[model samples]
Target: MPTEYSLPDTLDRIYTNQLALEAAIMELTLLIEQQGHTEVGENVRGALYAIGENAGHIKQGIAKLVLQHRGD
Candidate 1:
């Protein structure tokens, strides 16, 4: 038998991951502020920002998928 998947459960997992990513971004920002503009800090900050942006996009896509699935 094929494994069953639940849309709502998957959505919840995505949402939780998004929240954790946002929190990590916030913490990283604070650390950067405290550490000042060192080369390594700037590089790390940029990478974290990119990750946060991707996570946001992922969350939005998941939301759209949920909406479309429900409309069916």
Candidate 2:
């Protein structure tokens, strides 16, 4: 069982993490664009793309949580 503060606290943490992840994705996008490369190579670009996708999902999930909890 969780306390009253626990659910919101956990959601808050998730939101915070999503914000950071989105920022990281934006940074990667900038880097890739600045480099003007078609790909990130065999490992690096692949990892970045995967991270960006996951971050997007996290952001979406957090947004849903906010809507459910805060009526946004």
Candidate 3:
């Protein structure tokens, strides 16, 4: 059977995935730097920053939801 998830659950999953992606991006960035690809490393780091920003947004949203639904 298919599984079901609530809003918070979904958001948590998204946040987790974002973190994983961020880690992977960092690792890839390091590898690029090790290869002396400064330009490519910079580009990858830029993307990593964006992903981190989005993850922060997701975390904030999750906190807001928790506060909004505190009584529940």
lDDT tens readout by residue for model 2, 10-53: 86686677568757766776677678754553355566567767
TM-score winner: 3
* Candidate 2: residue 25 Cα off by (Å): 1.0
lDDT of 2 at 64: 74
Model 3 TM-score (2 dp): 0.78
Q: Give the TM-score of candidate 2.
A: 0.46
Better of 1 and 2 by lDDT: 1
Query: What TM-score, over all chains together, does every model reach?
Result: 0.54, 0.46, 0.78
| Per-candidate clash tally | 0, 0, 0
Error of 1 at 3 (Å): 14
1 or 2, greater by TM-score:
1
Against the true structure, whose lDDT is highest? Answer: 3
Model 1: per-residue lDDT, tens digit, 1-72?
A: 221255755776867886787688767767877877566667767787787777767777877876776776
Per residue, candidate 3 scores C-alpha lDDT tens digits across 41-66 of: 99988888888777767788898886
2 against 3, candidate with superior lDDT:
3
Order the candidates by TM-score, highest first — what do you get?
3, 1, 2
